[model samples]
Target: MTLNLPQLRAFLAVVDAGGFSAAAAELGMSQSAVSHAVASLERELAAPLLIRAHPVRTTALGERVLPHARMALSAVRSVEQIAADATGTMTGTVRLAATPTVCQGLVPGLLRHWREDQPRITVRVFEGDSGEVAAWLEDGTADAAVLIDPPPAAARAFPHADPGIQLATDEYRALLPRDHPLADEPGVDLRDLEDDPLLISPNGCEDRVRTLHRRAGLRFAPTHRVRDLATLIRMVQAGIGVTVLSEVSRSLIPADLVLLPLKPQTSRRLVLTGPQTRPWHPALRTLAESAAGHLAPTTARPAEGRPLPSGTR
Candidate 1:
């Protein structure tokens, strides 16, 4: 006896979609063709696999065979993914997740580069907090994710193809209104803000901010709790309260706000994370390399009177 993948797929699709017509639409096949495929599958197995009802259901034997069929299909797809990786062809959709800051600061450049390099590949991005990003990856909702200050155990749990590909290490900076008394000063310590009414965004960075405060033996009781990044910046612009954010986030600050480096020099590393066990797509690997390039240090230029390095351009 011979088992056909198409027939099995058709059977599964019908069961999944709950009707032959819906499965036909999903598979881009005529209803008659899908019905025929299921019929052929039944003939091969010499038993009825599905009950032809409004919402189709599997028979006892079909339920017994379903697991093996799904496994076979998954194995076949894995083999195909391996082949695609070996050939270095960037095709298919890549589901990606990242925090709003990274999406605003870095992903646009990566998208532009990807468009020019591999137009065949489509990227779908989802914005979420670091914890949500991890949830997306664990639930298979995203092929990969960009995380800020990911816990050490998470790295061990979901190791990527390029484990140490650091996208960026952004230093935390103090955002103060230009009219503030200490705005003109170079830097300020976290302890100095104890008396001031602080404004902190309740987005993904809340935990990180709390941790930083906790380390300083302080607590964060924001005078105003802001949820949106843009709104928070506008509030700071209006001199509502001071806030702290990463260096990359400075781009969002208006001219009236001054960005000062934190006195203690706190920073967080953003890393690209991928599935630990699944075979990663070549496009994802390529993306990882591109992301790492963003943080690659540039060579210092030679002084006008000094000798140039051999490979200096």
Candidate 2:
């Protein structure tokens, strides 16, 4: 049996774009054409690769095939880049994954800079929760990812990926209603908020918040578990409860809500790294280098406070 690039591209586009119609739009092809390509690929392999559904997902066999497909496509891109390099032009697409917080906070500036500096290279942003983002990098859905306080063991977990570069470290702060009692303070301690209901979002910072509570000898219990940052902010604005979030997330919070530095402040580092199970796409190296220059390693301290100690991994 013979496989081909168009079939593999169609399969990956369908998976990444989440549907044949969307994939066709991204690939600038007819939806039926994309579907036909995927079907042709499945026929060649003699196995169904995708589970046709609303969102479109990979089958068990597809999961096993994803990394190899990504490597193949990336290898082809590398070969294309070689030709482009010889002509003094570099071009390729890089898929970047990040948690919602980083998407809202850091990605905009980075994308803006990349757009100006690397005009030919395209960067696509995929925003998800921490676990989903990590999985995307591991499974080859994303070419690179910005991870929040990634554990040291991640180096071992993603042996094929580059050792991550420290992008930025931002401290966690208290999110409270404007009129709340602690809102008037320059900084609030975990113990100080213990009497009030604690709201927590399980995005990327839940574990860090739990650690903060434990360090302060408080329980990790949260009165409300919110999954979306906007909804969590709305709840805080409505006086439902107070929450703790990173300082970088200030853009997402409204003016009516107050953000105060945490006493004995804690911070989380953000690292940018490539996919774990595939060869680095040619454009990812350039993106990383641009990011390193665009974002200098610095701690995002609160406006009202000095830098605090770093949080545990």
Candidate 3:
């Protein structure tokens, strides 16, 4: 049986975008067209691939086919990139995933640089929680990602995959209500806020925050666990409780909230990485290399807290 590119792409798009309508929007196709493509693909394969529901899900067969579908699409992209490279004009879309903090604090500058340097290559950004971002990269939903202190095992999973490039090293800071007693202090220790309810966002920084408490010999108890950074900030503004967040998240903090250095400071490395389970796109490789040179000396900061060793992941 003969398979087609559009049919495969539609299948992958629906899976990645989570629904036919959303997939159509992403593919710039009519909903009927996207639905038809997937249906046609299923007919060719003689099995149903998706379980149609709100935020559609893949059937067991579809799950088994997903990796092959991604690889097939990636192979096509590689061929196209090869032709473009031979012409000395590289052009391709790179789906880049990042946590909300990186999206707000770091991505704009990187986009600006890419726009100027690699005008033909399109870079699309996807913002999610840290776990979601990593998952996207691993699953091929994103071509590249800005990862937060990715573990060593993630890199080891794909020996030939592009190693992560450090984008920035940002210290974690204590966020407090403006009128709080310790808000005026130059720095605040986790112990200093022990009596106050500790607010923490479980999006990406929860483990590091837990590590901080452990190092300080304090319990890892938190008063409220927030998932969204915006909601967390609003909670802090309304005097719900103080929280710890990356220094890069300062832009999201309002004037009424104060961000002070965390005593015995800790920092996490924000690294740009390609897919661990697939070949890197040519444009993605170029972007990764460019980022390493562009951000290295400039964004690197001395962390008073124990920093993860270089090339840790």
Candidate 4:
């Protein structure tokens, strides 16, 4: 069973606080946000983690699991301790696989900060498409990776609790040739490009891209299908096609292409995933937390879009 540390924390908090409202008060979040966090965790776990009494209680499964969850969370906390300058150093390499786009954006900034703080730690990066990123983790080729958050379909197949398939809470914009007709449009709908080619990562991670098109009633047939962001952006710059991208993807977009906001907004997950069964390592956990820090507030993008449209069918 996958115990998502954050979700498990929320579940434990609700249990300790006696309900969502109390948990929210203690956590400094709105009650609705607390409930949503718990529900999101339940979605990933695929089992109930709590029972609602006058004061909520852990289900037998939750009860059996809480102690371990507490232990795991505590361990996770200890691992992140090294990330704090006062906590001392973490030495060794952390092999990471990340999309070509995230590698270019988030990693660079984080590395600068990391190197200054922890001079001896080494980081080796493997760049690949989302599917390949996931493959490296599945095969133990890398310690961890950041891939697009799993879509519901992919999540159903993998069915392990982790970061749930959720859109990045960020806006997505369409990249088009500078002079393309849609450049002037403040927001373009997916159906508007029915006959045009679409470029993006192929295979399972294309879920967010395809779901956006299908929801917008757009039929995105790729004229030149490619997986790498650098290549995709080059093609779009060449006026070959348009592509959907997260804000982070813009880091790779060329000067020649224009970015347009998508009307029924869409975003993709830059999820951090690794083998759940592998024993947690200090080096690995520090890497995970460090990786998480790259997306930290100093690195966080502003929320800039409405939810994607319904009717993916």
Candidate 5:
């Protein structure tokens, strides 16, 4: 039997949100509208796709059918991207999850490039921590995600394509005032900064923040805590204390601070996560390469020294 796309999308939403009411909120429709759509789907399918209970599930019929339903939806979305791509236009929403810096600095360029190339495509970027990114991927919200840390093994994993999952790692640097004693050395070892109040970002800042310290066999004395890179940079400019952060996008670092590499060296793991079986889209593949350029050293040019790629404003 044929089913309408709205009803199928609603059915998927109901399954994802766990109940009709929650699904209604997610869909931005009245409860009655959600109920009506689901009822219509059930009537047409002649099978109950959801069990009406807390932590709902697919009825025996649903368990057998839901998989196919999701595949069908994924296929439909894929076909849409293909058609758009063939026309030299990117269409459909590619929901992306990323840390704030990558979202702020890199994605804009990617989106700009996508728009110039595929004017019809809509890209939605969500910013959050690694945990939030993973959650978005598993629950059918985000089409893709970037993380400064490795995704939990159980989460639906969509590995980064360019460098193959483990993106390039940078030494945990101790940013010191220009004239500080440590600034003269080519690099400062973590052990040398034994008493410095190690500035740390909030737990949600990004997974890379304190990971270097973990590898350096030390714990941070977080006397100063900030939420984003800008603030962390400002704190360093003020000489409040030293901080360790991702130097992946070197251009984004402030000009006022001196970024030095750690003697022992530390690396942060970067990964891209998505549903394991989600049908691949060429746009996504392009995005992965573009993302790597933004994160890894090879593709990125020096700050303000290099112009945006061809076709990007």
Candidate 6:
């Protein structure tokens, strides 16, 4: 038997308003209609739901079912609220995930733009490696993400999805000490660093770095490995070893370190991606738009598959 919403609502209104006439007035229905609705509900349930008296009240079974009715009604209203929020006005929380470097270098500026443009929308950011970010998007832990050169395998994981917008293409740069021999060069080639100690982060860029090396007909065996980008930069500053990273990561580099564009111009694409199978929140679209605007003016798109050219920045 179907538990009708209107009947349940009528039953609740009569109890709350204390009488059939009062509930009818509250609900803008006639007293007879309200009484019939309650009676029909009790008949369908095969139980007396309410006592027909001067002051209406629930029977024992009615009391037990009241909470469930309220909850179901509340859920329906919540769905409506979500629809309302999705259509026109932008408000509420927008959760985003991104890699550490993107969060450090690019996300702050995008956040500033959002704060100025849409103060009503609150944004929460989660930082992870590229792999973790992709997983977060796939598993519904995050609403959207800034992913770096997502591979075909990862996209296949989310079939029939939007390929996402390419925010900017960034070439990897060499972080070296001021006195390093390659520090003065306009650009350093990946092959040139074959014998030199290469320091890298174990977080996300390892695979891309290796791919770049392989394309250049060289092997990438990092002599040093660090967990975070800051430490990698510090290691380079201390003259421990040279490290490579994107130009977007310029914000994290120390003042004492030099940034040289890589030779053969290796670079990766930064994409703003969201789930395709699920509804994409409007606030996330707004965030993505702001990111595109912020990145477009200052950063040039790196030629696809080009290695970093030597340059001082």
Q: How well does model 4 score by local distance difference test?
A: 0.63
Q: How would you encode candidate 2's per-residue C-alpha lDDT over 1-313 as one tens digit per residue? A: 9999999999999998899999999789999999999999999999999999999999999989987888888889778767865686677778899988899988898899999999889999999988999898877778889887777665567644456566777889999898988788888888988888889987567888988988999888899999988889999888888999898898778889988999757898787777645567777766666666676535332111212111101
- How many backbone clashes does every candidate have? 0, 0, 0, 1, 1, 14
Clashing pairs in 3: none
lDDT of 3 by residue, 161-239 (tens): 5565667888999999999999899888889999888888876688889989989999999999988788889999988
TM-score of each: 0.68, 0.85, 0.85, 0.58, 0.65, 0.65
Can you tell me which runs of candidate 5 are displaced by over 4 Å? Answer: 10-39, 42-69, 81-90, 149-171, 177-179, 183-186, 202-220, 249-252, 269-273, 289-313
- Judged by whole-model lDDT over C-alpha atoms, candidate 2 comes out at 0.81
Which pairs in model 4 have colliding backbones?
A: 149-269
Taking the tens digit of each residue's C-alpha lDDT, what string does model 4 give over 187-216?
777778666677776744367677786787
Query: Which residue pairs collide, candidate 1?
Result: none
Ten residues in sequence with the least summed lDDT for candidate 6: 304-313
Sort the candidates on lDDT, descending order: 3, 2, 6, 1, 5, 4
Encode model 5's per-residue lDDT on 1-313: one tens digit a residue.
Answer: 6688778778877887788888887678988888788889888878787888897777888767666777777888767766765676555556788777667655677678767665555677888866787677655567777665543443334332222233334345667767667878888887787687667777643245455556667775578888767887777778778776655545667666677877566555445544554554435554544554555464333212223222222
Candidate 4 off by > 4 Å: 1-87, 150-171, 203-205, 291-313
Model 3: ten consecutive residues of lowest lDDT: 302-311
User: Which has the higher lDDT value, candidate number 2 or candidate number 5?
Assistant: 2
> lDDT scores for all predictions?
0.72, 0.81, 0.83, 0.63, 0.64, 0.73
The 10-residue segment with the lowest total lDDT in model 1? 303-312
Listed per candidate, the RMSD to the true structure in angstroms reads: 8.7, 5.9, 4.5, 16.8, 7.1, 14.5
lDDT tens digits, residue span 1-313, model 6:
8778899778877775679998898678999999899989888999998877777777899888776765565455446446755675556556689988999998888788889887877887989887788877765556688787767665467654555656677788877888887778988887887777899888667877887788889877899899888788878888788888889898887778788888766787787766645545545655555554555644532223322111101
Model 2 regions more than 4 Å off: 42-64, 84-88, 157-160, 297-313
Q: What order do candidates take by TM-score, descending?
A: 3, 2, 1, 6, 5, 4
